[model samples]
Target chain A: MKESLVIQANNLSKKYRLGTIGMTSLREDLSRWWTRSKNGIPKHGFDQAGIDPTRMINDHEFWALHDLNFEITRGEVVGLIGANGSGKSTLLKILSRITEPSEGKVKVKGKVASLLEVGTGFHPELTGRENVFVNGAILGMTRREVDKKFDEIVDFAGVADFIDTPIKRYSSGMTVRLGFAVAAHLEPDILIVDEVLAVGDLRFQNRCINQMKSIAESGKTVLFVSHQMATVENLCKSAFLLNMGQIIYSGKTSDVIKKYREDMEESANLPISQRMIREGSGKCKLSGIEFRNDQNKVVDSLISGKSATIKLFFDIYEEITAPMSLSLGISNSTHVRIAHLCMKTFGKWILPTSQKSFQVNLSLSKLELNQGKYYVTSFLDDESGQIIDWVTDAFVINVLQSDFYGTGMVPPTSQSIFLMDHSFSF
Target chain B: MQKQSITVLKPSAGWTGFDFAGIWQYRDLLYLLVRRDFLAQYKQTILGPAWFVLQPLFLTVVFTLIFGKFAQIPTEGLPPLLFYNSGLIIWSYFSHCFTGNASVFTANAGIYQKVYYPRLINPLANCVSGLLGFSVQALFFVGYFCVYKIFIPTASHFEMTSAMLTIPLLIPLVASLGLGMGLWMSVLTAKYRDFNQITGFLAQALMYATPIIYPLSEVPEQYRFWASLNPMASVVESFRFALLGKGSFSFHLLCYSTIVAVLLLLSGIYFFKRTERRVVDYL
Candidate 1:
C-alpha cells in the first residue's frame, strides 16, 4: 500500500441471489448439487439474449455491486450518494467487513470503524453508563481508552443526569445522542458513517458535523453515505454517485450532486403513462402534471415563496360511480413528506363523471418550500377509501430561494424543509 | 503514531480458519458482554441474583422429592440433598453454557449485522458468564454439603475423596461440551430456524441421558456404554464422585469423555466460523 493511500478497491463486486437472502431451502440446494454431480457443473445459459455470462453466477444471481472501483487517500472525506438499492449500503458493508465482497477485494491500511447505525449494539436493559462502555468496545475502543473518555462521552451526550438510568427509559433523542457520542469519540484511522447525522436537533446535527470535520482534519479518511445532497456538498471534497451497483460519477461533490439531481429529474420527466411503478385498481391513471407560474407561463422549476398552480391531468379508464379526491404530497429529497395538499381538506371533491380525460388545476398562493429537490406523490381515491391511482415520485420540483419577505434574506435549506409565515415581537 | 494495522477483506476465509488472535484482541468486548449478561439477567426481578442460587436449590428439592423419596432411585447410599444438589449445580453450569450459546447468533443479530468483531466473542462470553452463575450455585452446594455433614452424621459415604481433585479438570470439560454443542446448534439454527425448536428442549432431554438425577451405576450395564458415550454422562458422574465420593468414576470414562468433548468443540468451532461469515445476510 502507498503511504498516503487509505483505501483501495479494484473491481470489487457483490452478487446476491434474487429471491434467497443468504441460503436457500435444502431441497433446492440438493437438486442443484445433484444436477451438477450428474453433469460436472452446468455451463452458463448461453441462449438468453443480452445477458452477460460474467455477471451471472446462475439464474438467480443479481450483481448488487458490479465491478466497482474507487480509491481514497488519507485525510479525504468521500461521500457515497445513491438512490435506494443502488448498492451504497452494500459497498459500505463490504468496506466495514460486515459482509464480504462477492468478487475482487478492498485493501485498507488503517483501522476502519463503521457507524452503520448509531446504536448498533445498545441494550435496552443496560444503563446509559453501562451501554457507553459496551458501545465503545463494540466500536473498537479498548477498556482503558473508554475509561479515559467516559466522562467526556457522557458530557457530550448530555445524559449525565440519566447516566444510571436504563436505556429503555431514555427518550429517543437522548438515546440517539448517547449512541452518537460513543461512536463519535472512536479514534480510528478511517471512519465509515451512514446517515446518522440525519437524527437529533439542529444544534446536535451541527455538533456532529463539526465532530466529523475534526475526524477528517486529523488525517483520517472518512467515507460518508447519505441521501442528503446538501450535507454532502457542504462536507465532502469529493464524492462518488452510485447507480445500479456501478459508480456513475466520481468527482467534486457539487458536480456529483448536480448529476444526481439531473438523474432524478430525468426519471420524473418520463411520461406518466409509460412509467411502471404505480399502485391502484387502475380505474384511472395520471396522464400529465404541469407546474405554472402566476403569469400562466409553464415553469421548469417552482420558485420558493411564489404563487404557483399545478395542473394534473387524469385519464379515466372506467366511469366513476362515487366521489373522488386527489391528494398531492410534496416530500423532500430524502423522501420524508413535509407538505400535503388534499382536495378533501379544501372541501372540494370530484363528482362522478364519464369523461375520458380531464385536468384539475390546484393553486398554491405562496410556495413555502425551501430550496431543494422535492418529489410529488399523487393519490386518487374514492370516498370509500378505494384507491383509483397512486403514484410515488409522480413529479420532481426544484424549489429556488426567492425574496418572499422582500428583505432580501432567506435561510438556507438546511435550517428546515419548509418556511412558516409569522411575526415575532419579543 | 504507530503504523495502523492493515486489513484485507476477501470473499471468505477457509472453512477451518479460527481467529484465535482476533478473539483475543476483542477480549474487552467479551468481558463487557459477559458483564452485561450477568448484570442484566436478574434485573427487575424481586430476588435479583439470588435466583441464580435458588434456581438449582429449588430444582434439587423437587428432584429429591420426585426421584429420590417417591421413586426411590438409588443415589449410591448418599443423602438425597447432597447427591441431587451436587449434580444439579454442575449440570446447571453446563446447561447454562449450552442454552446461552445456542442462540448466540439469533440473540445478537442486531449487533452482529452492523459491526465486525470476532463472532466467537459472543459464545465465549456465554461460556464465561455461565461461570458466574455456576460459582454462586457452587457456594450454595457447599452450604448444603456442610448442612448435611452436621445433621446427617451417620452418612459417612458423603465424605470428600481424593477424587475431588479432578474438579479443576471437570469444569472445563463440561463447559467445552456445552459450548461445542451450543456452537453447533447456533450454526444450524442461524439459517434453518427449525433447529431452534430442537435446542429449546435439547438440554432438558440430554439431562436425563446424563446422570444428573441418578448415579451412573444405576444405568443398567447393557445401556451403560451408550449412556457413557453422551460425554456429559461421564462429566456429571465424575463431578458427583468427586464431591460426594459415592458416584462411579473411571479413568477410561473420563478420557473417553475428553476425546469426544474436544472433537465436538473443534468441529463446532469450524462450523460456527463457516456459518458466522454469512449468517448476517440471512438475519
Candidate 2:
C-alpha cells in the first residue's frame, strides 16, 4: 500500500450465477449453491489458460470481475472507462458496499458515499421539499446537516418555486438537479459517481460537471465512471481502462483513453451483424447493414466531406398495414447519439402493407464528421412510433483522415465532430 | 485537539464487519424508516390509521362471536370481550411486526441497493413502529374493557392490579419473538423466496396455534405440550392474566419463551449481517 493511499485493494473478484433471481426454483438454487460451494465454476475466459470457446461451459456461472488491483490516494480523481458490462458497475458496487467481492480485500480509510444515479432515494410521491429530507437521509446526511444546506441545495437545483410540489410532477430535469445538488453538498470523505452525466441536457451536464470539479477541488477522493472519454480526459489525472473484467491499462487518463479506443477498434473489422449485440422487439430484424461510397462500393471506412451512403436490409415477417419507418443513428465512441436519420422524415410516401425482405438506402451528400471511428444504431417503427426493432451499436464504421476543404489541415478526431469548409485569407 | 477518523472495511472482512456502533450511528435512519412505514401504511385511505384499531377491534368481535358466543369456550370465567380483545391486542402487534420484519429485505430492496447502512435498522424500525400501532389497538381494547365493565357489573368481568405492571415485560417479550422469528424468516426468504409465502401462511396459522381463538386450558391434555411450544402462547396468556387477573400463568414457560426469543434474535442478527454483504447483488 502506498503511504498516501486512502484505498488499497488486492486481488478483488466477484462471481454471478447465470440465471436471474426467482427464475430458478429452490431446488435449482440449492443445486447452484452446491456447485458454487464445490468450486465447480467452469474455467472461462482469463481463468483458463488457452482460449477454448467450445469447451462445454457447464458451471452456469460467470465472473463479472476478476483479479484486478489498483490504489487510490487521498484527493485523487480516478476514472474507470470501459464498454457496457466491462465490470465497471460491478467494481463500483463492491467499492460502495452494495455487493461483496468474492476473492479479495479493500481497505478504505474514510466515510464513503456512492451517488449511484440522480435521485437514488427520491420517492415520486414525496414533495420536493419533503424529498429533500428523505433523499438527504438516504445519502447519509443528518437532518441538521440537511437543514443547514437546505437553502443552498434548493437554489442550486433551481426549484425553489416548486419545492412543495410532489417530485413525480417535477420535470425529469428538475428531479435530477435536486438529486445531484443534494449529493454534491454532502461531505463524504470519499465519493464515487457512476454514469450520472449521461442524463439531462448539455447545460445541466456542464453544471453537474462544475459541481463535481468543486468537490474534487475540496480535497475529496473521487472515483468517477463514464463512457465520455472527453469528460474523463478533462477531469481525471489517473485512470484505469478495463476490458473483459481485467485492468488492461492504468495510468494517465489520455493513455487509458487511447488503450480503450484501440480495444474497440480491434473488433471493428468483423461484419457488424456477426459481432454486434442485438436486442429489440424483433418485430423486424436487421438482416444486413453496409456503408457505401458515391461509387456504390460497399466499404467499412469513409473519408470526411464525401457523399456517403448507409444501406440497411431488413426482414419483415408480418404484414404492415401502415407505413413503417426506419431510423439510422451514428454515435461517436462517447455513446452520445451524434446524428440521426429517420425514414419517415426522409421518405414521404405511405408504403402499403407487405410481408417481404427489403433494403433501404440512405445517401448523405457530405459526411462532415471529423476523423474518428463511429458506431451505427438502427431502429424500425410503425407510423405510431411503436418500435418494431432496434439494434443499438449494431455496426462499427471508421471515418478516415481526409482534408474536407482540399487543404492539408486534416482535422484530428479530437478537434470536433464537424469539419467546416473554410478559406484562409490572412 | 485530536481529529476524529473513519475507516471502511472491505466486504470480504466477513464477520469482523459486526459493529453495533454502526447501527447506533444510524439511529436517525432507523427512526425515519419507522416513521415512513407507519405513515405510509395509512395514507390515502379515508379511514387512515383508524384501520389499525378498527382492524383488531372488528376481529375481536368476530372472535367473540365464533369462540365466545357460539362455542361457549370457557375464558377461565373472565368476560369474553375482555379476554378476546386482550389476545387480539398482542396478536395484532406481533403479527404486524412479524410480517413487516419478515419481508423487510425485499420490501426495501430499492433503498438497500443504492445506499449502504446497517441493514438491521430496517427490522428494528418495523418492531418499534409496530408497537406504536399496537398502542392504538390497546386503546380500543381498553374501550372494550370499559364496555364490559358496565354491562357485566362484576369483579369477574375485569380488575386492574399489580399484575398489570407486567405489561411492560409482556410487550418486548412478544415483540422480540416476532422480531426474532421475522428476522430469521427474512434471511431465509432472501435465498429461497418461497419462504415468503410460507412466512405469510405461518404468520396467519400462528394466531390459531397461539391460543388466540381458544383458552389455553381447553387445549386437551395430550396436545398441551405442543400447543405451549409457541412462545407467544405464554405471551398472550400472561398478558390477559396481567390485565384481567384471569387465565393461566407459569414463570417457567415465560422463561423458556424468553430464552427462545433471545436466541432467535441473536442468530437472526448474526445471519442477517452475514447475508447483508451479498444479498443486494442477488436482489
Q: What is the interface RMSD of each candidate, in Å?
A: 1.9, 2.5
Model 2's DockQ score:
0.38
Off by over 4 Å in 1: A21-58, A271-374, A377-394, A397-426
Candidates, DockQ: 0.50, 0.38
Question: Which pairs of residues collide in model 2?
Answer: none
Docking class of 2: acceptable
Which residues of candidate 2, in runs, are more than 4 Å off? A1-3, A21-23, A27-58, A270-289, A292-329, A333-336, A340-373, A377-394, A398-426, B1-8, B11-18, B150-156
In candidate 2, position B240 carries an lDDT of 82
Per-residue CA lDDT of model 1 for B1-283, tens digit only, reads 6887888887877774677888888899999999998888877988998898888888889999999989999888988888888888888888888888887888888888789888999888988888888888888788878887887788755777898888989999989888999999888778766667788688889999888788888888999889888888878888888888887888998899899889989999999988887777767
| Residue A301 lDDT (model 1) | 87
Write model 2 residue lDDT over B1-283, tens digit each, in one string: 1232545444454455547897887777777767666655775688988888888778878988998899888888877777888888898889877888888778778878878877888788888898998888887777767777777686444576676887898888888888888888888888777888898899889989998777899899999999999999988888887878777788889999999999988887778887777788777
Chain B TM-score, structure 2: 0.93
lDDT leader: 1
Lowest lDDT 10-mer window, candidate 1 chain A?
A43-52
